[model samples]
Target: MNSLVLFLLTVVAFGSCLKLPSSFKKCDRKTTDFNQCLSEAIYGALRILDKPLPSHGLPSLYGVEFPDVFTMGNSTYGLLQKFYQTRYIGLSKPENINAKLDFGPLTITLTIEATYSQLTVETEFEAQGTIVLLPVNVITPVVYTLVNPTYTFTFVLEEYEKGTTYFRVIDSKIDAQTQGLKFDYKGLFSNKVLNEEFNNAMDEKWRQIWILFKSFDEVLFAPLFGTIFNDFLKKVPAAELVDG
Candidate 1:
């Protein structure tokens, strides 16, 4: 009788562990769709930055797709964390700091800020770093220099206009090297064209980051947290079990 009772109890416990296949089917589908939308939006933004703009007019022509998704993903995550802390948690006071963006041959670092009022964007060349020289005892040392340049271009947008809007940069300060290096070593270097292209590229990056923030807020955060909160309330047990 004792063995039969134990067998019955084990079978009941096993049956209780089974879950209906349809229980989470809709949630799974929704999660997949959300991921796809986020991926495409991110891809489109990156496509805008991949190539350098051709030298022609005030706003040079170029696609903004390149730079692996991993780097951009990090930037997006950092921005989201900042948003949650500043807007939701009401923690530390917001302030400006130098943020760095690196492309293969070029790096644009900016001093930006997040506040209750608006978002400020700015960019400058990276300057403060060590330069490695080849052959320490060579007759003539070939130096591989790392230059960090400073730039200040501030574009402020009202907090309300952040997600569904765009801003134009009317004025900007350009570094001499960037302005002079428009084309290859032999080609004609136009300072005007170089500055215009550079500024346009920076603007595109700013917009891309903004788009990422919107996607995270609307799709990922909204669905995941909402479901988790609801489920948590439903599943919490009213009483604790004591050890027999």
Candidate 2:
């Protein structure tokens, strides 16, 4: 999740400097068909962002690396977990991508939604805890393959200036729905059979488990997203993004 957020920030921060090819479309906020145009523009941009734009200081989305380690403290949540060296692929290939922008009298609301045919996440984890009262002592490779997952991000932005027009997210929400999930774990229970069974059970109940922890995930992600977004906005004048 954290790596996903970082990928977005990387795009926005460097995207401002892109001397987009003439084929890339631009939408004027003043047009009555602005939202539709913006959606198309976003879709076109996604198709081309897989490659690095070094002249614009942007790395390829396909090969982005995440080196930070994350620790989830002990809690009733049932997992004392730490994960690091994670990598994800297939972010630049979202289907049915759309973006909507509503500039109200008091706030600017932006929503982006997309579905991925398959998103693969690989990471190493160390966990020492209990789930369903069963001991969990494992340090191994874990792979999550999300099939046909749709993700939506909505932000209510407030305008501000740091020598230029910029916006900061004052409120935000993120939601995801997946058609299917596949989980791979090694040495989960010190028994291959138990591991396979546990993985299957988790895949079957992935949505329910995500819902149980969604709020906690939001608490950890929202502020970090806001901060990174604000930094990105600082690089490009708000007027250039939308002239209202």
Candidate 3:
């Protein structure tokens, strides 16, 4: 009896997850590239497409965390006129692949959240029986966070592959846009006045992190075409893109 109950619960859970979005209904049998069609459907649900190549509406939701703790010398941040911090803090909201570039690139508008970063330098002299090496040997555990804030992305397609008529992205890079960005630092510094000064100074800043958010759609694109790509790839008669 317990086994049967467990099996039924599992089915119920999975059934809800497998529910296809009403968006896919647009992908009818006549569509030549089922892989492409499926891609259009899911992303299109987010927003109507504008430019053609790289088909718009791709979802961009990815989070990256650096494993290593930073310990940069003070000379490195001399340009920024700042020191190191505690830990890195930052998060991103899912963005949509809306605009496209003629040179072969795309842009995504994102909401970058705030971060909490702190800096600690090592010194040659001991503080309370601890040896430190000035700012050069700083054990900087940076905390940089970007609370949900509006931002845009512009990146160029780097590489791609295809087994069926569909495509898969390999990599990409950032193009022109707002000044290189940094996340909100108010929460970390705990100084509203100082934070405001920094925010106001670099109001137009943007980050490679945001670019990561946009480019990630390429990661999802190929996978989305997975089942369909295989279906046509293996199907007899070698389906043509237009009618397959």
> Could you say which candidate leads in TM-score?
2
> Taking the tens digit of each residue's C-alpha lDDT, what string does model 2 give over 1-244?
9998878876765555433456557778888989988888867766776886544334555544566677876836687888777776776788787789988998999888878898777779898889788878778998888789886778899887544456777887777777876888876778889889989999888887667435533564455445545555555556656656
Ranking by lDDT: 2, 3, 1
**CA deviation > 4 Å runs, candidate 1:** 1-205, 232-244
Higher lDDT: candidate 1 or 2?
A: 2
lDDT of 3 by residue, 1-244 (tens): 9999878876654443222234333443454464455444434533322211122222222222222232322444331122222221221222322332222344212111112222111212111111132232222222333333323332222222222222222333232222234444333234568546655554354464546533432343223323322332232111221232
Sort by TM-score, best first. Answer: 2, 3, 1
The RMSD (Cα, Å) of candidate 2 is 9.0
Pick the winner on TM-score between candidates 1 and 2: 2
Itemize residue pairs with steric clashes in candidate 2.
none
Each prediction's TM-score against the native? 0.17, 0.73, 0.30
Candidate scoring better on TM-score of 2 and 3: 2
Q: Model 1 over residues 1-244: C-alpha lDDT tens digits?
A: 9999878876764443322122111112234354344334323322332332222111111211111121121222221111111111210122222322211232222222222222211111111212132111111111111122122222221111211221222222222111111111111123557535644554445444434534433443333323322232222211110001
**Candidate 2: TM-score?**
0.73
Off by over 4 Å in 3: 1-22, 25-42, 45-167, 173-183, 187-191, 204-244
What local distance difference test score does each model get?
A: 0.25, 0.72, 0.31
